[model samples]
Every structure is written in structure tokens, then in C-alpha cells.
Target chain A: MTTPPTTVPSTDIEVRGLTKSFGGFLAVDDLSFRVEPGRITGFLGPNGSGKTTTLRMLLGLIRPTAGQGLIGGRRYAELPAPLTTVGAALEATNFHPGRSGRDHLRVLAGTHGIPDSRVDAMLELVGIPAAARKRAGGYSMGMRQRLGLAAALLGDPRVLILDEPSNGLDPEGIRWLRGLLRHLAGEGRTILVSSHLLGEVEQTVDDVVIIANGHLVRQGTIEQLHGDPATLVRAADPAHLAEALHGQGITAEPATEHGPGALRALTGDMVRIGDVALVAGVAVHELRPLRTDLERLFLELTEAPAHRNRNLTGDATPSTSTEEQA
Target chain B: MTALIRTELRKYATTRLAWGMALAMFLLGAIFSGGFGALYVYGSLTPDGTPVSEVVPPLVLARLVYTAGIQVAYLLALIIGVLSIGQEFRHKTISGTFLATPRRGRVVAAKVVALVVVGALNGVVHLLGCLLGGGVLLALSDLPVFPEPAELGRTLLLVLLVLALWALIGFGVGVLIPNQVAALSIAVAAAWIVEPLLGFGLTFLDGAEWLAKYFPSQATTATLDLFTGVDPEFARTLGGAEDPLAWWTAALVLLGYAAVMTVVGWLLTRSRDIA
Candidate 1:
């Protein structure tokens, strides 16, 4: 807040050690990240992982217990014209059911002195015009989200913050929304969208800030997470194989259901892991080169180790080879 | 600020709930004024031994029927205020509102000023209702059917003042109590149950009779009483014993309640996070 907008106009959003707490429990703990201009940065987390809380703080809906959430380097309260500078749809149902979609946007536009023409344009932009005259209560979940987005865009703001924007959207609606976000970012408008799963936004967002248990667990470009392909192999003694592979300076992750019933290691070359397994006298029941999918990588990075263990072991069998052998 | 007011006005106009509540207010005013005002005021006697049936000094009939209209106007104003302001919180639209108008204080001011206009609308409709009710009953009684324009205008001005204040009170209550249903319930219960009970209970409490004059509803009535005396039965329900305060004094007291609530509510909104 001490910094002026002039200092960070290109950096649309900045969260520096932002923390929030209820009376006893901390909801968001020391989270920090910057949303660069002209990119869709996914704010990914679990249901209670503080994505919404952080977005709320950034929009000035909730006060941060520590640090700051700044837009254009100014606190939201200090943004002389917040509506025109930042348009945020924090939730899908933040509207009156009694009002029409058009009326809803018009009332909001009135607050910022936005013209009526823009309301109509936004209605067309969000593609809810057919339902624009109907009461919002009658809107389907996808329609409500479209209206929410329409309301956010009323001011033609430079930055858009959407929390769980695709919650109730069908695949088609979600595809339409992805196109919208990509188009907005293409025009150099910064967009920050939150979802509980990275796959939900991996195609839409260029960068990612991932959180878990109210803390930043991982963050980087989608390429950074997905570029490093790995290897999957099932061994008769999986834990022994994991330790033996670790001796060669390769980190082995416990296997997920998609893995070939073995430890999954982050590496593109299959020969190195095969050489280590051969040295350790472990039986390689299955071995295959693997590409890291964003969703599995997200789960590996965010879920609790114990939970990840259950996740890695519950469906992981001895080996498909063992079943074939039987 | 003008845009905000327009937005609030539009919000009320577009919502079916607002129109429905307002229509109810208008009908209530009409029935109370025409049906009940006829039974209570048409044949009553004035302070100087003049019959309300007399056509001269239209004050006798104007006062009789306008007083009934004032009570109905209060209820209507309260309803308008609650619906106008309460729904923002009820529907969790306060976030949208604050987002659009980041200066929370301005939203408070806009809400108050907008409700004042709605309050005036309530006044006009209630007046029409009273004319319908009282005019019908007076005609039935063989008294003068209506007051002259000058007398009619004054009664309307008084009723408008009362209704506008009640609306502001409703807006203040809406801000202070964030729950829409709770704020509205308290508003109705205060006017219908709490004020009447307190006024009735304090009537025989020798030293505390003066406390009733300070009640918001009573203060509004007391100010109105300056132009015309209230019913002895109605007055007694409000801790009735003495003449009302000077017209201006009662006006100031009633206004003080509205000013305090509005200003206090504004301060709270300023400090608290909307979430």
C-alpha cells in the first residue's frame, strides 16, 4: 500500500506475505506471489487451501492479518476507481435473484458511471443475452457465472480476478470461458483465476501459483511443471527399489494408479533408473517412460504426504504383470 | 452520488418485492384512513366545541383524518425502507455494492438520500389512501367531504415529514443490522409491539411518563401533534398524560434519532471489512 500505482502498473497483482486468520486457526499463512501483466495465472488450491481468501484480500473484501495484497501497487481501497481498474468475480452467486441479468449489470455500471452501452456489450460479451431479461433466480449455474463475469467486465477493467469461475460450467461452457480468458490476456489485460485443480485451468492459464494447507507449495510456468517427463517402473520390492534409485541421486515419487505399479521418478531417460534397478538386484516387473500430467503433478505437490501415501497405494497393485502371470 | 441514488432507485423499481410491498403499504393506508378514519374521526368533537361535521376551519376534519394517515404512513415508510436497504445484505449483494462504490461512506449517504425520496412516495400514496378512507367515511357521515387545498396541503406536508423520517430510520436499521430479515423483523416489532407496549406500560409510571415522548414513533407523533391533537386513546397508548412538546422540539428529537443511526452506521461500515 505504501507503494504508488506508478511503481507497479505492469505487475497487475502482488501478494507479499499475506496472511489471514480466524479467531484461532490460520486460513492463509504467509503466501506470496506476483501476477504479471497479460497472463492467466491459475491460483490453484484445495477446497480450504486459501485461494478464495487470498483473492478476497486482494479485492479488499477481507483484511489481511499480515502483509499486503496490492493491485497496481495500491491497496484496493485506495484505487480511486476500483471498478474501472479491477473487475473481480469472487463467487458465482454474488447477485440478487430478483433482478434480471441486464438490470444486475446496469445497477453496477451506474455505480461507476459506466454507460448503458457497455452493459449491453458485456451482456453480449458473456453470451447470456438470451437470459438477460429473465430473473437471475431462473438462471442456470452456467448462466449465473456468465452474469457474474458480465458484471465484472462492466467497467472494462484492466485486471480480472475470478475465483472458481468454472465451478458449475459444463465442458462447453468451460471451453468458452477459456477462450474468453485467453482472449482477454491476449489483449494484455492481466487475469487471475482460482480453481481447486490445475487441470481445470492448465489449458487456460500461462503461469501457476499452487497452494496447500494455506501455504505456497509450488509455483512456476505450466511448462516448468510439465516439461520434465519422468519414468514409471514396477519392482517386486518397490520400497527397496525407491531407496536404491535414490542412491543414484534421482528422486523417486511413490506411484499413482496410472504409473506402472511402481515408484515414479522425475526423469526423462529410462536407462538411468533401469541401470540403478539392475545394480540393486530388483526385479523390474514393468518399466515405461512417462510424461508428467499437470493434474498428477498438482496432487503430488499439494496433498498431504499421508494422504498422498493412501492415494499412491490404495489403487496401486503388485503389478499388472503379476496379474498376467496368474 | 447521483448515480448511486439512481442505481438504488432502479434497484427498487426493478424488483417485484419492492413494488409488492409498496402496493401493500398504499392499500393499508387507504383502508386505515377510509374505513377506520370514518369510524373514529368523522363525528368527533374538536377542542373548542366545534363538530368535525362543520365545514368551516377544515382543521377539525383534516386533523382527524390526517392523524390516522400519519400512523399508516409510518408503517408504509418502514416497509419501504427495509425492502430498499435490507435486501443488499439479505442477498449478500453488499460485496457487489461496496466493490462498485469503494468509498463506503458514500454508499451510506446515497442509501439515506434515496430512501428519503422513497419515503416521500410513501407519503403521497398514504395521503391518497387517507382521502379514500376518510373522504368516504366523512361523506357517509354527512360532514364536509374533503378539506380545502390549503388545509389539505399542510396535512400532506406533515405526513411526508413523518414518512421520510421513518424511511431514514429504516435505512439506518438496515445498515446497523446486516441481516435483512432480522432488521425488518425488529422494525415491524418496534412499531407494532415494542413501542406500543412501552408506551402503554409507562402511562401510569408517574415519573417516567416523559420517557415515552422520546420514543422514535412517539416523537414523530408528538411533532405531528403540534398541527393537530392526537386521539386520547391513541395518545394514552403512547404514555399519554400531557400535551406534546413544542412542534420544533419534537421535530429535532425525532431527527436526532435518524442522524445518530445513520452516522453511526456509516462509521461501522467504514471500519469493518465487508466480508
Candidate 2:
């Protein structure tokens, strides 16, 4: 037995051609991404898009069918002290039901000869000291999330991998998590959090990796991926303005909800759109650019495949994901 | 290895299921001992027309060992063994356990050690109950109230071995059937009903005694009989008993079951992705 190492080197994660196949179906197919040090990367996809499977492979909970997921140039299984190097919460409800939160953490600590003080520190760190004595079975989903976070952070790990961490958190808990993730990233730690909800990870993540149907559809900084932002332009005589735009060989759609006065150009080249309006002898009332939120960008990039998948499944909503499968 | 074992021991000690089953085992052992002692005090000792007063120390201790140690203690040990691994799958804690120790083989080894110790402790408690209950009844009936030191030590040692093996079997059963409810049902029914019914049914065939002796329950009896040094004359006098295998042969068969179940269970756990 050895004392748990207090210092963990901050390290980046690189997944190279990672693939996972369950029987005949490919859950994560040729997926590749890099989580740089000092950045929070959001692993985003629709349900059943293989987010959890990729995370599990990265954490070494499951063997990859092909390729490798590396943490600081080493496979997770090769790390001498994996708990300190990579802390993972693959599922929020994975703890033993009958054990207290404190005892649960203590068991893991005992394995590595980690001191009792580390357990108490984690309890305090996750704000579960009041409920630490209670059995995990009786905890609410919100509390379970906290306990899961505490367990993941118990070793003061350099890399944190969390799957749908905000699923059970209330608004306040979500805010706290956002601040904490930012703070951890500020400390040069690499964080990979996967979620189906784009809104949840939009503010917290520095980079976003969006996938659909077991394949990467897009990956870049939030700004880099929000290319050719759209703008709303309200014009007098929208029919005549539409003709003027048609004459210029640029397509424009009527702002459906903006009533008779508005048209929207798909491109963010406002100067050209203004020049077009001036030439058409149309007066512009409201010319404002709309900053695309992650949800819209996500839908634009991945919606085609997500829609095709939903059609095959005969369901309107997204299917359940890697957590549901083996 | 010590840390893993310590964690396993703490896990067993902390669960209500483990403590509850242990307490039940002790109470059942004591009650069964008292009942058996009363039967010895009043009922016929040997079917060969021997008087109750003529009952020897070996026979009395043997009956006590068979009932309290083999019958009662073995069942309790099996339940404890099954829970050792069953509860982890039941409560979905295997993920955390495997995460802490990525090598699954280490976890299985630790479970074996933990359950064996727990089995031994339960065996000691069960033996104590038998002594206290049987000793009092013999003293009340004014028969010889004490056994020779050799007889006592041999009986205690046999009880411990029987329990430890039963526990190993139980752990094997749990690993083979990880679902808690399904595993418990199978273990109980297989032990209390299925094996005995098969053993009894096999007796109808000509030259079937040989087949009947290999049944799990009969194998258990052979183990207890061989370990406690049951004499051949006494064994023949009882019409209820069957011809058992040699003690060492019976031991080998029982251990073979444990080893096979363990290997199969480990292989199943190794191949599947835990979700």
C-alpha cells in the first residue's frame, strides 16, 4: 500500500480513431477528439449518439473495439495511479445503495491508503457533509449527483470525465457546477463533460464536439463553429424587397413570425445586404444580427442525421443512449 | 491485497443483510441444538435396541454436529457467501468496485478471503450454541454431560471446515447468478429441495445407492462424517443414512464444484461489459 499522491499533473486527453461495437451495432465509430489542458470540452450529441460509450472507453471502463483513448500520452489502464490522474463519474447512481456517502468514499480511499482527511475534504468539497452520514439509497437524484462529483474529485485528479453531470442538478447546483468547472479549467485541468442538452454545456465549455449516428459531425470552438451567423432585416414592402433580393441573385426568406415587415438573409454580410436593399429602393427598418445559440447551431449541424435516426426508430424524441446499452 | 481484503471485510460488516443473517444463524443453531438434545435425552439413541442411557459420546456429538453444524450452519454460510458478490451486483456497486481495482481477478480473490473469514466466525458461533444447548440437556437428563477433549476439538474443527466450504459454495453460486433475488432462490431451492429430492428419487433404481451418494447434500454429509471420524459400525446401524464416498473423494468433488463455478463466473464477468 502507498499514500495517495497529493499532486496530479495536469494532462490533455486524446482519443485517436476510437471505435466501440456492441455485437453487430457500432456505438462509437472512428471517433477522434482532443481535450486540451486548461479547457472545458463539451462532448455533445443526441441520445444514442455514443457519447457515454466514448467516455467509458476513455476511462478504461470498457475495452475499445479499435484504436485507443489516451490521457497525457498514456492509456488509462497503463497509468500507475489512475484515480489521481483521471477521475471519472461514468454514471451518477453507480455507488452502493446501502453505504453512507462518507463510507463509500472511504472504501475507495482505503484501497490506495488515502488518509481519512481526504474523505472529509471531499465531503466538504461537494457540500454533502450534512447528508454524509445518510445512506446513498435514500438520497435524491440531486444529492446523488453531488456524491458522484465528490467521488470523482476524491483523488484530486488532473483529468475529470463526467457524463450528463447536470441531469439531476437543480438550477442552483448547475450554476455551482458551471463555476467550479470554469475554476478547474482555470487551474490548467482538462475537463470532458458529455451531455445531450446543449443549453447545459453552452456556457461552461470552451470547445464543443457534436456527433450524430456514431460519427463526428462537427468539432471546433463555439465561435469557430457558429459560421455565417444569420441576421434579421425588416423592410418596407417585403414582397418588393424580396424581388429586389431575387434580382441580386441572393436568397432571402420572410421572417415567418416577424409579420409582413421583415425578411432574413441567411448570410451575416450586412454591408452587402444593405447595399442590396438600397438598390432595391427598399427602406430598412430593423437590421440586426442574431447571435446563434448552441442549440440552434447544434440542430443545424446534427439535425439531419438525428431526424433520419428518429425516423428509423419510429419515434419523435431522441432514443436513449450508451447508458441504456451494454 | 490486504487493502482489498480490508475493504471487503468492512463492506460485509457494514451491511444489515450480513449481520441479520448471522444473528439468524446463531439463533437457529441454538434452537436446533436444544431440540436435538431433547430428542437424545428421551428418544431411542440407536435403532439396534440400544438404551438412551447407553448412548456413547461419539454418537451424541455426531448427531449434534450433523444438525447444528452441517444442516443449519451450512445453509447460513451459503447465504453469507452468495451475498458477498450478489449484493454488489444487486446494488449496482460493481462499477465502483471495479473502478477502484481495475483488475477484476483481485476483487474475486478478496471476496473468497472475506467470505471464508466470515464463514469461520459463524462456524465458531454456531459451535458455541450447540455446546451450550446440548451440554445443558445432557446434564438435565443426568447422562454424561461432557465430552473428551479430542472429541470436542474434532467436532469444532469439522464444523469450521464445513462452514467455510459451504460459504465458498455460496460465493460460487452468487458469482454464477449475480442477480440477488434469483441467486438466493436458486441456492435455497437447490440446497433444501432439489438436491435431496434428486438423491431420494435416485434411490428407487437398482444399484442407485452409488449415484445417490454423489448428490450435493449427501456429499456434505460424507464430508461431516469423514471429518468427525464417524465409526463404520454406527454408520451401518442407521437405516436413514446412505453409503457415502470416501471422505477425501467427497472433499475433492465439493471443491471441484467450487473451482468450476468460480472459473465460469470469472469468465462471464470478464467478457461482458458492465452497464
Native interface contact recovery, all models:
0.74, 0.43
Q: lDDT by residue for model 2 over A36-128, one digit each (tens)?
A: 888899999888888888887876778899989999999876777677777787777787788888888888877677778988888887778
Candidate 2 lDDT tens digits, B111-195:
8888778888888777767766766776677765555657556656766876887888888888889788899899999998998
Q: Determine the TM-score of chain B of model 2.
A: 0.88
Q: Each prediction's Cα lDDT score?
A: 0.76, 0.76
Q: Per-residue lDDT for A32-114 in model 1, tens only? A: 99898889999998777778888888877788899899888899989888888898897778778989989988889888888
TM of each candidate vs. truth: 0.83, 0.86
TM-score of 1: 0.83
Candidate 2: list runs displaced more than 4 Å. Answer: A1-8, A228-289, A310-312, A315-326, B45-53, B58-69, B143-146, B226-241, B246-248
When just chain B is superposed on the true chain B, each candidate scores a TM-score of: 0.86, 0.88
DockQ of each: 0.63, 0.47
Scored against the true structure, residue B265 in model 1 reaches a CA lDDT of 76
Q: After superposition, how far is residue A100 of candidate 1 from its true place, in Å?
A: 0.7
